[model samples]
Target: MISSISTNQIKYVLALEKTGSFSEAADLCFVTQSTLSIMIKKLENQCNLILFDRKSKPITLTKEGEELINQLKLIYQEFEVLQEIIQGTNQEFYGNLRIGIIPTLAPFLLPLFLNKLVTNYPNINFSIDEITTQEITKRIKTRELDIGILSLPIEDQELIQTSLFNESFLIYDASGTFSRNKKYKIKDIDVSRLWLLEESHCLSSQIEKICLLKKMDTSKHNLEFKSGSILSLLELVNMNKGLTLLPKLATLQKNLIKPSYIFNLVNPIPAREIGIITHPNFSKKRLLDILEIEIKKSVKPLLDKTKRIQLINPY
Candidate 1:
């Protein structure tokens, strides 16, 4: 009969790898260093491998140990997948949901239903991180995050994306060169006078594609300020007497960015399809469904794409 490895032992190995210290790893596992050391020794005996270099200060994993740790990560993730599948089938929503949200959407979207999720699913815990699209995409792939709320149709084959809602972009023009309630075309954008979020933001890429904004001659617009936040972008536009594309949800009354300054795109009304992204291995269907539902319920009435709206592919 094959000797069964303890899950706790696997967890200890992972903790030790993460902290690179016996005592710290033991503290993380809520055990004494000697206890954790015994567990590691037992695991080594069972697996017939030397897992760590205890002689090294702040212990290092041996070459064989590195290989085993990689295997252990895969095994642990698969074990977690099994647990999630069972919990999903049992309708038990009692695990931590590590979620990553892109900055452009986080401010507007999270306020709509985050509180509701906490209130409704009291058993579920949340570890919400405000991250950039690139960061979240990488995190989702590594299983660091359970879900990612980001702009959809990511080209990654490893991620399974679920359509949430279509968010229409509104042009915020402080100079009023474009008429209010008028439909503007992408070609109509004065790239020199346009204010955009920084390169790190996915929305910046989307806007760049939608507006066909390339390298502009700085002589027309003096300073170059690539803002990281939508709010910051708005301020830059206001101060520079420029224009920017903003999502409908972001232009809410509370934001104080004036509805009269907002304009819809015509000819091909450009919008982005926002969705919930997850790793293919992720199996928290119950938690995923609830979060998706809550977001849709809150934002649907405000951003009903059933009306005339054209979508632009940012990818």
Candidate 2:
């Protein structure tokens, strides 16, 4: 009776499950292709079952193999969680946290919060990916990232969002050409003068709603660039000459040169809701909770607390 299996066997099985090719899985596992095939054969023999249908294109798992691999994945994730827990206790915040941040927020927001994270939890290491909101959601759902910082109303039932702060958007126009009026109405926007991030960014969609720019109207707007970072857009505005919406967080510091050409939208204002997002099944709940608390604390001082803001539903 074959009663024993090794951790090496499990690793080989998982590698095959991911790559769907024995040679690829073996390369990933740092073994010969024949070695991986032999290990999988041994595992199946031990259980008296076929784990994979080798003849199937792309290597489909057998019915029993599918269920077994599902359990194996859970076991592997749990093992990681246990390893983190043990490591986290000895040192303040030990273990790597893989996080994804939306591009618009990453540049302005990370510097504000990272220092405190390092000071408080020096043992924790970070693997950060700055990506678009769409990418963040996809990666989080696939278990590639532990947390995502995104502008909310993220509707995915598979993820949970913690509202961290409500930041306002200021309507901006080319300085001398348009009034620097504290409150410019939506209808009053010089639509022809408006500059926008290219199509995919959620920020672009929110800007369309905020400025009341019809889809066709945006199509008519001449120069189009696909960037979500307000800072870069601001530079473009300064050089190329056009108006764009900016997050309040981008404007908080006096050092950020507000090109002598800028204006704010009036009452019935527009804003974006920034929040911490995590997969519902994220393995590091305690770390996320700690991160949320720290981020909120850091952001409170940077905000213009006097201004009223609105949260958009992330459809």
Candidate 3:
């Protein structure tokens, strides 16, 4: 009888991808180099394909090998879920809960709720990844991440979003150019002096859209700077005498500048709907409910909420 691909063989391939060298992969898989190579060769023979480019120094995956590895990842995930299902039937959310949070939210939000979350659920093991919104969505779909805290309208039909809060943008000035007004107009502001996070961050894209700066050619400007860290931008704003917009939660953090410099956007105030996103098939109902309640308790009191805030459409 023809044998099926073994889980150990699949693991060897994944380890090789991570390590890039067979010796390192063998060390990780706790086997001799010959043993690991033999197992992979067996898998290749069973499938009748060359899984690796033997001519390459560290060995890159062949086109067919890449496709096969993707399927292997799915199979491995299913095996884990099957085990979780059996164990979860009797336990009460005591195992590791994998979570991903966007860069914009992780710094400000974690400080507010992480301590309380750990104190209350001491038994619950938590592993969190600070990543981009797009990455979070991809990982959740593949069952790599259980939950994500990010600005919403993920727009993926496979994911379920639960609104947690609405965070409005606040204009923080250090350039000494912006005057204190109840309302600020985007056009009136100097786009040249505007400091923004890098394009990889969803928040920066949201700001670009709302301000009608979609085609804003920053290259012509005498100075160009893009940062991924809000805290870094805040420091640069103060040092370089520049200006930037900040999310409500970020403004509440440690700031060298005074509050008198902060201003709000006028009618139809621009905001991003912050929410928890999970796979539709994720079976962590009790855990999700508890986390939602805890997060709301920590954040709601600090937020200056209003019906006037408009969620920017993520196009």
Candidate 4:
């Protein structure tokens, strides 16, 4: 009975599952809304199962529909793998690659390798979304995103993580609270005057762990501001005479207000492991290999190698 179903029908069903709205799903599948609807209805008739509950605001799958969709996702992933294997044999590289990166890493890291990567492989269309670690993980699992670049180690067992490099955290002290000549220890930092990204960002959690700020009162500072951008955090830190922790790459931005404000941690230096993640069944081995090599090469010279380091988990 399954042999009667066409691949296009499967594609439409999965697209609808990914996007609840019929119009949105049609856009993804590059078909008219009516065409997509009819195809899905035909699929439902063939299977003799009421798949989506159309009465719902944003259409939702029934219990049986959910189970079938799970199997369909695995089957579609295999289809992707087969296509990638066939494409690998060809010398020309051309495909759509969707990537999700954590906001903390996106700005600093993208500049290092993205431009060259795009220019070198004009045939491959690249789409990047700067999002949180949780969103990145969710998108990768759903096959919405082809790859993720973020801090390690994510606890999800369904994904594969490849370590790229270890980036140490640095003190961005606009308050002159710490001497420039000395390597600052965690105990040296005053929690009261410390600034941080909003709690949603994984970097903020990692920084809190590194400094053991969980038990301390972070609201003791004169001003209480939560910013999403590292650039904004820097500006606020300078204006309010406060300090914040920054990943090493963020400190390398060209237009930072004061280069003298950045300070390294005392040994062993607190760091985060930066890496790429993909679903276990991801098939773009060539793209993954290329990205790993380019990113490592770009950051190798800029990252400090002499210090003893301890990794902070983002989760």
Which is the leading candidate under TM-score? 4
Best by lDDT: 4
Compared with the true structure, what per-residue lDDT tens digits does model 3 show for residues 195-294?
Answer: 7787889888887877779755667446566778887878777777767788888878755447866877767778888889999998878899888888
RMSD of 1: 18.3
**lDDT tens digits by residue: candidate 4, 150-241:** 99999997899999999998888888767867767888888778888888889988988987877436658666777788888888888989
Worst 10 residues of 3 by lDDT: 215-224
Q: Look at candidate 4 and tell me the lDDT of residue 257.
A: 45
Cα RMSDs, all models: 18.3, 19.1, 19.6, 19.5
Cα deviation of 308, candidate 1, in Å: 4.5
How does candidate 3 score on lDDT? 0.82
lDDT scores of the candidates, listed in order = 0.83, 0.77, 0.82, 0.88
> What is the lDDT for 58 in model 4?
90
Using Cα atoms with residue i matched to residue i, what is each candidate's TM-score against the true structure? 0.68, 0.66, 0.68, 0.70
Deviation (Å) of 157 in candidate 4: 1.5
lDDT of 4 at 172: 88
Give lDDT tens digits, candidate 2, residues 52-110: 99998788799989879987777777777987886677476578898898777787888
